[model samples]
Target: MILELNDVLTENESHTLSFMASSGELMCITGGTAASRTRWLLAIQGFSHISHGYVCIDGEPLTERTAQSFRELMAYAPERLTTLGEVTKYEPPTVQDVFSLKANRDIPISNGILGEEMRRTGADVSDGRVQLLAVAVLLDKKILLVDNPPKETSGYLKNLAKQGKVVVVTSDEDEIISAADQVVEI
Candidate 1:
C-alpha cells in the first residue's frame, strides 16, 4: 500500500501513510490526532481526494478505472450510526428480512441464518434494523475500515480481522502499536 498526502491536510500539516504487506502481515496506523491515518484509510478505499500523493495496491495506483473495479472490496463502518426505524423480529419483518433485502438473493446464506450471526456479534436481532444490516454488509467485505474503535467494539474488530484485513485508524498509539503485526506512525 502507498499513501501520499502533500496538501491534503490543513496548511503546513503533513499527511502520509505507506504499508507493504506480505500474505499474513497485519498492518496498523498509529499517530497523532490529525486524522492522517483516517485519510489514508479513505484514500485506500478510493473515497477521498489525494491532493499531492497517490495510493496504490500491489503496485497498482488507485485510478478511477481501478477504483470502479475494486469498489466492492472496500467497506467502511463509520463511528456514527443512522437508523430509519426500530424494527424487531415480532414486527412487520425480522432482522433476517432486512438482511435479505440488502444482500443478493442468490447468496447461499439465508436471512434466518444471517440473523443468528448478527446476534452472535452482539447486535440485537429482535429489534435490529438497517444499521444492523449495514454491520452484516461490512462483515462480508474484503477490506474493512474502522475509525477509533473503542474497547467495547474491539471484539467486533478482532472478529473482522480474523475474517479479513481490518484497518483501524486511531490516535491512540498504544492500541495500534501493540495490536498490529506491522505498526505505522503516520
Candidate 2:
C-alpha cells in the first residue's frame, strides 16, 4: 500500500505539503499549530480538499469517481475522544459492540485482538475511544490516520506500522514525532 500527497494545499490555504509513505512505515506530520497538524491529516485522508494538487493511493489519483473507494481503504481517528461521541451516555459498550455495527460487521473480530488493543490503549473495554481504536484496527485498512494520539498509544501505532499498516499520525509533540519512522514537518 502507498499514500502520496503532492503539492497539496490545505483547507486553510496557508500551507502546501507533500510526502509519501508505504506499508510498514510510521509517518508523523508535525508543525505549526495543532490546527495545522489536523489539516494535514485531513488532507491526507481526503477529508479536506486539496486546492492545487492531488492525492494518490497505489498510483491512482483521488477523483470523484474513486473517492469513496479510496476512503474505504483508509480509517481515521480524530484527536478528541469527545469527537467520537458520548462515552457515558449509556451502558458502556464492549469491543464486540463496535464490531457488531453495520459498518464493521463484515470484519472478523477476535478476543485476542481486542485484548491486545485494550492493553495497547491502556483503556478499559468500556472506553469509547478504545472501542473506536479496536474498530480501526479490525478494519485493516491500508492506511490509518490518527490525530493527536495519546502519548501512551504511540507504541501501539508503531506496532501497527511494523505489521505493515501505513500509519499516519499528526501531532505537535516532540516525543510522538521522534517515535515515527518518518517525520514530515509542515
Candidate 3:
C-alpha cells in the first residue's frame, strides 16, 4: 500500500505539505490544533479538497470519481466517542451490529475477530476504539487514520504497521510521538 500527498494545500492557511508513506509504517502527524489535525486527516482521506496538487493511493490520483473507493480502503477514528447511529443506538450493541450498518454491510464480521481486536486494542467491549479497530481490520483497509488515540492502542497500531498497514494518527502525546516510525509536524 502506498499513500502519497503531493503539494497538498490546507484549507485554512493554504499551507503546503507533501509526503509518501508505504505499508509497514506508523506516521504521527502532530504540532497543530485539533481542527488543523482533523483537516489534514480529511485531506489525506480524500474528504477535503486541496487547492493545488493531489493525493494518491497506490499511484492512482484521487479525484471525485475515485474518492469513495479510496475512502472505503481507509478508516478514520476520531477522538470523541460519537454514536455510530444505529450501530450504537441500541444498548450495548454487539460487534455484529456495527458490521451490520449499511456502510459496512459488505464486510464480514465475526465473534472471533471482535475478540481479537478488543484484546489487541486493550479496549473494552463498549469502547469505541474496539468498534473502530474491528471495522478497520475486517475491511482490511490499507490505511488507519486515528485522532487522539489512547496510549494503550499504540502497541496495537504498531502491530498493524508490522502487518503491512499504513497507520497515521494525530496526537500531542509524548509517548505516542516517541513510538512513531516518523513524525510530521504541521
Candidate 4:
C-alpha cells in the first residue's frame, strides 16, 4: 500500500484513524456515526492534529514539513461550497464567476468537454468550475480528496476518477462505497 495507518485512534472522542491507498485504486471510508472518518482523511492530508501514530506515503514518514508537498499532490473539496471571489450569498456568482479563477484557467481539457462535465455535476455553473476542477486534477495527475459529493455532483467526480486516483470521505453512505475499489474504515 502506498498509504498506511496502523493503530491510529484519536483522543478527541474517536477523532483519529489510519488507512492505506495506492495508485489506480479508489478508496472509500465508511462506518458508524462517530467513526472519525473525516478526521482520518484530514490527518492524512496533515489537516488534523495528532498526538500519536504516523503517516507514511510511499515508504516515507509524513511530517509537517513534508505534508505540504504531499498536499500539493492532492486536492480537497470541502463539505461547504463557496463562490470563488465574492463571499456574500446574495451576490452569489453564477458558474462563470467561480470558473474564472486563476486555477480554472490552467486546466488542460477542452472547453466543451469541460463544460459538459460541469453541467453534469449540477454545479449549476455555466462557467464550468467542475469541468475545470476535473481537468486540472487530470492534467496534474493529483490525488483527489472529496467531501460528501451530492448524488448530483458525483458524476463529474466519478469521471475525474477515471483519470486519477481519488480518496473520498463520506459519512455512513453506501452509494459511493460501491464505486470504490477498496474500503478502509477508521
Best model number under TM-score? 3
TM-score of 4: 0.65
Residue-by-residue lDDT tens digits, candidate 3, 12-126: 8457777787899989988878778878888876666688888998899988889878877887666644444644321223455445656677666677876776777865657
- State the weakest 10-residue window (summed lDDT) of model 4: 89-98
Q: Total backbone clashes of model 1?
A: 0
Q: What overall lDDT, based on C-alpha atoms, would model 2 receive against the true structure?
A: 0.75
- Global lDDT of each candidate: 0.50, 0.75, 0.75, 0.58
TM-scores of all models? 0.59, 0.79, 0.80, 0.65
Q: Give the lowest summed-lDDT range of ten residues in model 1.
A: 2-11
The digit string of per-residue lDDT tens for model 4 on 36-88 reads: 55566666677666678887767777788898777666666544445556554
Q: Which number leads on lDDT?
A: 3
Clashes of each: 0, 0, 0, 1
Q: 33-145, model 2: which lDDT tens digit per residue?
A: 87778777766656667788889998999887887788778877665444235555422234444445566787766878867767777545565556566667778788988
Model 4 bad stretches (over 4 Å): 33-35, 81-114, 120-141, 152-159, 162-164
Worst 10 residues of 2 by lDDT: 90-99
- For model 3, the superposed segments whose C-alpha errors exceed 4 Å read 81-103, 110-112, 123-127
Candidate 4 shows a clash count of 1
